[model samples]
Target chain A: MELKGRAHKFGNDVNTDYIISGRHKFKTLDMNELAKYVMEDLDPDFYSKITSGDFIVAGSNFGCGSSREQAPQAIKCAGIGAVLAKSFARIFYRNAINIGLPVVECDTDAISAGDELAVDLSKGIIKNLTQGREIAVKPLPEVMITILNDGGLPAHFRKHGTFNL
Target chain B: MGKTIAEKILSRHSGTETYANEIAVAGLDFVMGQDGTSPLAIRAFNDMGGEKVFDSSKIAMVIDHSAPSPLEGVSALHKLMREFAADKGIKLYDIGCGVCHQLMPEQGHVVSGDLVIGADSHTCSYGAINVFSTGVGSTDLAAGMISGKLWFKVPETFKFQINGKLGRGVYSKDLILYLIGDVTADGATYMAAEYVGEAIDNLSVEARFTISNMAIEMGAKAGLMRADAKTEAWLKAHSDRVSQPVEADPDAVYAKVKEYDASRIGPQVARPHTVDNVSPIEEVEGTLIQQAMLGTCTNGRLEDLIIAAEIVRGKKISPDVRFIVAPSSRQVYLEAMNRGVIQALVEAGAAVVTPGCGPCVGTHNGVPSDGENVISTANRNFKGRMGNNRAFVYLGSPATVAASALNGKITDPRRYVR
Candidate 1:
């Protein structure tokens, strides 16, 4: 599985409230509606600044607060190709994978905003096209890979008739 | 090898020998969701072709995040949850029943040593009773609802050994804040924080709940404490189920261990935009506050309210401050009311709203205005947490918040604790 995108960089401890503010959650649970405000708290022009298939690169502990699926769902709905960070809050990592959003854990110091990059999931490598460097990432667990291959937990369930893992 | 509580509980539920860094498919003893997350779980459950829940009796849902529905869209979502709960014969805690974290334990949905999961991050609060509970997203919650099982990468345990009696006006909230300050927000990512020693043993179940509730602030998957006499007594009073406690072995391996003397700790607060940006009350003292809230899953119990009431019993809060108090549950509310705690707060100019998570999540009720400063007992102080990104939030204990409300500034509570 290969994903190509531009990188949008953020800092450490990016909480869920920053991913999608709780105010928008009060108005709608619709991911598309929430997507318009995705990362709006952190970057007001985030939605308009990037195209589909762009990546959100960040430092450690990304998505650190709340278990609101809207955080990951909004990112996926906004057509983000993946999220790369040094680490992730456990729930957010699980949520992203459950929703079929690729959350890669690797050192993101080399990636900068607007840098063209390609991720090869199977190969566990990130090709920084703009910088002409390749960074290695740990391969996801087999079960997560299977779920991501099936487009997320729901689709995986639809195909397997139960939680395959 | 010795095992920590997390490893033991996951091993028990998974029917395998599990340890840190290993993935285990564990059966859930209970599952829950709140209004903020249940609507999505219901949708995902339906999407996964779920017709009937794995166990209706073990499933619960609460409408507390935006209790009473602040908008038509949210109300529709509430209705969807209602219909779904009815169709599945699951328990539905409608508006005002309480925050799910409080309700789950108070309503007897969980017990010590159980592997519980909820669709809210604060689900880790149940770890106060020795449960290996953690939060998950809606889809994983749906999966748990459908299959009664979910996978977890059993987290390494971080031990916090705190001893010595807490000083006057120094509550568990302060200690937890102090710990968060030392560790930073992501210090314990993917780890279980096991708190023990004299301090924990001496604290009430409610105080323990406050400590465990904020474990996520340090990126801990679960904040656990061994269930002792106090925990057993509280469980006996609040729940009918028998408790089965798990404890880490003496030789249990830990990722890291830190010790603290609680007596040396003072009233602590987390300043604006981040929970880990903590400071002693002296550092943030005299900062003007526009609002002071005294409730949430973090500190809305009867003891917390009683503490606040005692602080502001006969005095009026600052006219410039809009003081709000929301009990964590109807049971706590009724208990406080019968004990005159609510009357004292109201008499002191505090508006006691419905028992649920309203202002804390910025859903409705008492959102702060732009550029306003608010002090609250609830956990988390991230930007936009209170509905206004421009507003500033300070996190403190109930006593601290009440004391600050009296002065309309961030003030230490020790002066008023007597």
Candidate 2:
């Protein structure tokens, strides 16, 4: 599968509280409602600044706090195509994939804010349209691809009646 | 071919000889979710066509994140968790039961060598007792609840060998904060942090819990320690289950190994906006604070409360500060009260709240106002962690928080510890 978007860049250690604050979680659990406040702490107008299918590009250890699914769910709900980072905290990595949000581990130094980019998941390649460069990323394990193809763990379970992987 | 504690446990559970970076599907010994994450897990469970949970006895749900429901929407989510727990015949820890991390071990749901999973990042706290436990998301928790099994990519281990003895004012909180500052937030990403050596061996069970609980802050999958006599004694006091500790092989491979002289470490603190932004007490001292918190899953045990009480005995806190204390559990509350810890704190101008995660997660019961500064014993000092994004949070030991409360500013606890 392939994804195309303009990158929304962030620095290293973009924690979950910064992704979506805990204050919002207490107020509501609705992903769409929470999506309105995604990255509001770091960028006050993040929700209004981007269109659907945009990408959130971050440095190492993205999503490095709380196990709130809302962090990934909010990104997905905000219609982000994927999150590309140098690395991810373990729980956040599992969460993004389990919820059908593609999280790619790639060197994001070549990509800047608002850079047009294309990611081919199966082929493990990232093409930076703005920089005219190509970078390699480690392809996700086969099970994760299967789960994503089935539209997340819930949908995968719905189709298979159990954990297929 | 030697294996670390994590590898051995995973291999035993998966019925395969697993190693680092290898994927294995293992049966879970226990599964847990708190109100913060359980509501979503329940929704995902239903969406996945889940009817009955696999082994209701092995499943637990907690309601500590926002106990007593600060809003109607949150109340509805709590209700959903309650009804789901009831319907599935799972153990439900209602409001005031305390944080899930403390309750799981206190209630005897965890044991060494068990593969446990929770929908809270601090679930790594169980690793203190030698369990190979880690956190997951709501959907992953739901999947584990439904199938009683989950997949894992065995993590490489990073071993921290600490020696010597800590100073009078220094505690495990300072040591862990020092480690975080050294490793940075992501240095141990996707790795199991094995904390062992003379310093760790000398720490109390409660102190070990504090160290393991913040493992997630360093991006570690789990923070583990080999079970010893102290662990056995603690397990015996907490539960009837027999201990099955796992240890790393002498020749076990490690991603990296770090050593420290605990005696040389001073009282440490993690400054605002990020946990890895650390400084010694001398650097951050005299910074004014509006609130001082002494409780959470990290350092809310009886030992912590006792230390705070000792520092504040016969002395009143600064009138400019709002000193809050919330025990991690009812058991801890009862023990503190029995030992006069609660009385000392209350007499010193502290407002002791219920036994749960009060003001730690920023849900309710002490949310700081805008631009305020808070020094807390809880882990994590990210922006908005105390419910207000504009507020600043500094993480420290309970003694430091208590001393700072007395002075209305960040102060060294050593002057008061004696």
Candidate 3:
């Protein structure tokens, strides 16, 4: 499946507290319910029209502070196809991996705002169609790659049933 | 080869002849989660369509974060966590308890030498007991929940060897804030910090916890202390189990080492917008405060209360400033009350709130109005943390916060050190 849309580019250390301030964490349990506040600071209109294919590209240290998983889950549930960042906060990077939201740790210089890119996990490539160029990201290590392929950790566990490794 | 705490634990846990790389992830003994991340994790569980937890009953769960009057999404999230816990027979928790990390050591989940990963960053609070713990996001929680393990890169080590006795008006909060100024926000990024020294040993468990708790604000992976007699004594009072007493080998290698004389450390505060932006209370002297809060997993211990109580004795809170003290736990509140700390605060016009996260996130009580100013002893003073986005937050120690409450402005804590 190809994801296509304008990019939301950000600089380094874009923490969750910055993305959705802790005070604004809605009590609603629904992921779609969280769409109302995604990137509320940068664009209060962010949640209204985040098409299924739009992607969020961050420079580095994305998703820092507070282990609140709502940040990624909200973004994913809001229909963003993937998160492209230079580096990730240790935890959020793992979180996105565990929950099956595609987070690619590639140099974010390849694309700019309004540039459309598609992350092809199966191909280990991000095609920057907007620039008529493409960049490749080192795929997840074999174990994590399998988990991502299985749609994240839970899905992998469900499919394999259990593990001894 | 030098060994950091993260390396020591991971190498030991990974078995000898390990890679000894600080950038590699290691397996964890137990994973922690709370209501804040539990609900979303449960849905991830459902979405994955799983049955049993990936691991045995080695997981710790709590119902903090959105407790004691939650917003819309939070309340429903709490409901789902309970249902998920029951269905999977996961070690679930019910409400009416307190913060997740507070209950961790209380419930005997965070044992010595254990590597723990919690869904919230303050989970670093567990490090007070010699545990290697750090906070991860909900997705990381889901990952650990599914795999029964966590990946941790070995972290660089920063040794904060502090000496000297804490003077009057000086608390662990102040010393730590002073340390943060030197350490800076990203100073210890991806590093494990060891707060060793005479002063730390002299500090109470709550005080040590306060220091270790804020270690994450400096972008640290975890903060550790040598589990000395103080840790032993504190553990005996709280729990009966103690094992894996680890310390740096005398010849242990360190990436960096810092030494501080706590006696010389005075009241420090972080200016608004950044935790690394620290200065003495004297720098921002006379900056009027509209609110003064003394709590959070950071400095909500009994020692913090006593510090505030001593400052407020015979003095009244500024009429224009709302002084709110929310202890980290009910046990802290009870202890403070028995010790007259609560009376000192209340009689001084300070309002005592419940034992939960509020002003820390600016979602609940003590939220300053737009453009107002406040001082707190909590972690992080990011925008809208204690009120409106426009509201200003300055972070100080409990002493600075309490002393400020008396005069309604940032005052030097050293003046009251008598």
Where does model 1 exceed 4 Å of error? none
Runs with alpha carbons beyond 4 Å of true place in candidate 2: none
DockQ of each: 0.85, 0.85, 0.45
lDDT of 3 by residue, B334-377 (tens): 87889888998999998988777766776676778888888988
Interface RMSD of each: 0.9, 0.9, 2.6
Give the root-mean-square deviation of each candidate in angstroms: 0.9, 1.0, 3.2
Please identify which of the two predictions, 2 or 3, would achieve the higher TM-score against the true structure. 2
User: How does each model score on lDDT?
Assistant: 0.93, 0.93, 0.76
Writing each residue's lDDT as its tens digit, candidate 3 over A1-165 gives 556677888877667776766665646566676667887755668777677778998886787677777777778888888988887776677677777788888888888987878777777788888898888786665656766777776666577643322
Q: Candidate 3 - CAPRI tier?
A: acceptable
- How much does candidate 1 score in TM-score? 0.99
- Candidate 3 fnat reads 0.56
Query: What's the distance in Å from true for residue B143, model 2?
Result: 0.7
What DockQ would you assign to candidate 3? Answer: 0.45
Query: What's model 2's interface RMSD, roughly to a tenth of an angstrom?
Result: 0.9
lDDT at position B204, candidate 3: 81
